[model samples]
Target chain A: MQIIIDPYSWLLGLAGGLLIGLSAALLLIGSGRIAGISGIAGNLLFERGPDRGWRALFVLGLILAPLIVGWLRPELRAAAPTVNAGMIVVAGLLVGFGTRLGSGCTSGHGICGISRLSPRSLLATATFMAAGFVTVYLIRHLPGLA
Target chain B: MKNLIGLLAGLLFGAGLTIGGMVQPQKVLGFLDLAGVWDPSLAFVMGGGLLVAFPAFALARRRDRPLFDLAFQIPTRNDIDKRLIVGAVLFGVGWGIAGYCPGPAIAALSALHPATLLFCVAMVAGMWLQRRLMR
Candidate 1:
């Protein structure tokens, strides 16, 4: 098998990863809140709480941040979504519901929780990664699937 | 001040996702496709994040209260239940299929990506359904 390595990816990934860590750290150090997008967004809709205002603001920033970047660097615009509408819907529903039931998403459980040394986060991360690997394998390699 | 800080955190997180290639569905899918071309760039991203986060968490643990808040609000639950595993599996399946995790999906909506609106709507609906049925 051939292994492809892209230096640009490694550089950008590291830089971006640092930024993500910084952001999560900022949230923790500043307001003591976890940078869990699902918990923030879902709670805004499903449950009313005092933190709702800040959560909404954070979500708004998330929606606006990309536009701000694209304004400064048009070339950095995100890639288009090519998956069919049906497939996207199914995926979206699963993500929303699953994250809720599981109590976190990648940002929450994968990044923040693990960083906090939570055992539940460790298990959740391992399970999700395994499932993701299997799902990708089945979708990409199985005959007539892709 | 807290709201402002939260907004900044969100902005930084969104920028990180975009810069890390997570906002692009193809890149995410590429990372997941281990049997194919197999892009391991995302692993580097995770590693980089963890490197900084580990120290940041240490700082957090030493503090009784956050800089701008009254107290820390971390999750204390340690039990790993069936719901957790099942939900994680379902979330992973969705992620594998769409290459859009929760954060990046919401972040991509800023770009007006064609499918994002429907996906977000469905995602919100799913959340609503879970709240009603799961409780």
Candidate 2:
């Protein structure tokens, strides 16, 4: 609970967040979409309608951007995967199912929804954040629980 | 046209996530660990995003329709329900546990880590399972 001095780069975080916001804006203005990644990914997997084409392309772009960037600057790429496989699988399942049932993820509810000032999104964001905080508290503080 | 726009938006979004450091589980966990040495970078990311998105969405609200699409396709339901709350709680727990939200996990795929690949597969399977259970 105590605030330790942050060592990470806030400037980098802000720059990245701007890009995310720009992407959402572009999607909204150009295609009338919300740029909700989970919704897009989920629909791409299950839907077979006319919307599938764009969804596929969008996901492809998401996958390729890092590869392209890494090719240009390898240092910018994500570090090696460190989380254990068991935790990864459980977390992935929960994320996938939860986002679907909830109809949004961090991007959907956190970025786009919150910016629009939707009450539902505000509440959802608060709920999830609280839940995340509590979960982390349990895992890190409650020895032997994690 | 819409496909091209989708690709562009996706690229920007993915790149932003990478640049913002959301792709790292350790960093994300640090942000989530309020009881520990909390990294406030995630808050900055959200703040920056809101700064841009707020005006952009406001502009969109004033428009009649999108440039490519005939209508602005967005969620209409406003009723807060149990499903939304429960699902979000579950997602938060999972995020806290593994530090990979949907976007960062997908974007992290370029790293080609086997665990990332496995996580993506499990995530898709989870999505499928949710639909099946609901059906």
Best by TM-score: 1
Worst 10 residues of 1 chain A by lDDT: A73-82
For candidate 2, lDDT tens digit of each residue in A14-109?
988999999999999998899899999999889889889888888888888877767776666865346678888888899899899888999999
Per-model DockQ:
0.78, 0.78
Q: Please provide, for model 2 over B1-135, each residue's C-alpha lDDT reduced to its tens digit, 9 standing for 90 to 100.
A: 999998898898888888788888888888999888888888888988898899989999999999998999988888999989999998898888888889988998888888888888988988999999987
Interface RMSD of each: 1.2, 1.3
True C-alpha contacts between chains kept, each model in order? 0.73, 0.78
TM-score of 2: 0.95
**What docking grade applies to model 2?**
medium
Give the residue spans of candidate 2 off by over 4 A.
A1-8
| TM-score per candidate, chains pooled | 0.96, 0.95
